[model samples]
Target: MSGKMIDTRVTIDGTFGPFDCRLDPRLCYTKPWFPLAETRKVAARTQYLAYKHGNSSTETIHVIEGRTDGPDSVHLIEGVPGRNGTPAVAVRIRWKGARPTATLGEATADARREVTRKATARRKAARSGRTGAPRAVVVHIDWCGLGEDFDEAAFVVEPSADGLYPVGAPEWRWDFASWWCPACQDSQPWHEVTCPCGLSRPATPLGAAGWNAGCALHCLTPEATSVLVDLDGSARIVDVHAGDTRIDMDRHAEPFGQAEEILRTALAEAKPGELAATGWERAPGRLWGRRYQITFPASRP
Candidate 1:
């Protein structure tokens, strides 16, 4: 496995029925498929046991991770990446029994979710809170109408909030929050908490993360990814610079993370209707799973 890929592989003896495997952290971190250090699994499953009928072994498979009541569900299990950048799996199973109407192509249609016998640790660890070092990022946008008027067209940005401005054209960002305020354009303090008028409820920008989780790596491609944080590790941000644009609504990031310390510091210094982007020159983007660059698009055209 490469350093920036999220994937898992399983091998099973047709007669044994279960496949057990564990991965090195360095390899597993590159994938969104992180599991517990140890896992017991069944690759292929079937309803009827052909061995009892003197034919031999029939394969059966069941997949379940993150428990029945968790938020993360297996969106899919494919043999490879689709036309778009989606998750995939390459599974090889053997079954010598019955006159089943199945082929490799047909098998794709039968993709099933697999379950792990010892999945308790994977479930809990994924939900646990972890803290890491503090990193900073800076976002610079050519904007106008940077304020909190709710109808100002956009919020002010930091680094240089000396002048009022609205962000790029509509559809540029689906939802977002600014480091500066529109009413009084100026750089905001490092720790001021911002409010988000997200899709449903009020999303609180505890710091810089966008409204949607996917936006965490706004400027990064998967090739440079390194880490993936749990849900509680980050907060949501809603940036409605114009209308409903994916580039606009998103989440902000901190280390594994630093919410309270950062939040407390920001709220203490920032005044009402104000904002600023920390550490000038770059916009934030996801790389290897965490936010690493502050001054984004260092190589933009």
Candidate 2:
């Protein structure tokens, strides 16, 4: 199944049969010099209609016309399979024209207003338990043609929160490259560590560690006082004691299944300063032995 658009005509090669339709003139508009200036006009003229085959047959279902204005361009037509499996389709026509520009003050004000509106809507949806529909996966096709000469490219479109999917186009917030913080629910960049709400980023493993280390310390008797193990396979360790640490086998030699055996042996036979004898370097944090938190690569492993 596939779809193509040439000027105002949209054609869909559906499962049951081919669908042909023309976009309403009101729903189509010239890309304006100032997008916001045309926002109200486009919003007022937006239309939606469903197309089906014979009256008795209920197999074919397609949204032939559903127009909406987006941040980048206007979505002229969007279609989704109804009951039977049909490929999702989107037709976006970007007219060749000069790019639009706006005054700094106008752009800033519009951005602020849009942010506030989206934030408010997200909060309301959270309270009402409405997360909207999940993004849809589809095949996107791009074509350029002049007379008989044309170039075409097609790629699979994976589901993402930032993209305008056929199923969730109406609800897409246009917050590209950003995510909702779990702590405050405010949208933040994916790379940001601390959110404006004063929440510190949670700990996550940087990458797979070559070596596995298990440390055990005993204050009295043979029983272990504190035992620490690197189970996450990350290169870093946090909130661990810096006493006699035992560097175990490389992760490849001994899988995590032997973690219990490794822990038992370290607690029973390992002693302090054994790590240094193996020529493994140690760089402890400010509170080294007391509240040890260090990140050192396991070069030998």
Say which candidate scores most in TM-score. 2
Q: Report how far off residue 286 is in candidate 1 (Å).
A: 48
On the 0 to 100 scale, the lDDT of residue 69 in model 1 is: 26
Q: What is the total number of backbone clashes in candidate 2?
A: 1
Candidate 1 lDDT over 203-299, as tens digits, reads 2332232212222232332111112222223421212122222232223435212322333333343335333332212224553332222212111
lDDT of each: 0.25, 0.27
Whole-model lDDT, candidate 2?
A: 0.27
Candidate 2, 2-91: lDDT as tens digits: 122121211112111011122222321211111221222222222112233321222111221111221222121222344543322232
Clashes of each: 78, 1
Error of 1 at 118 (Å): 16
TM-score of 2: 0.18
- TM-score of every model? 0.15, 0.18
Clashing pairs in 2: 244-272
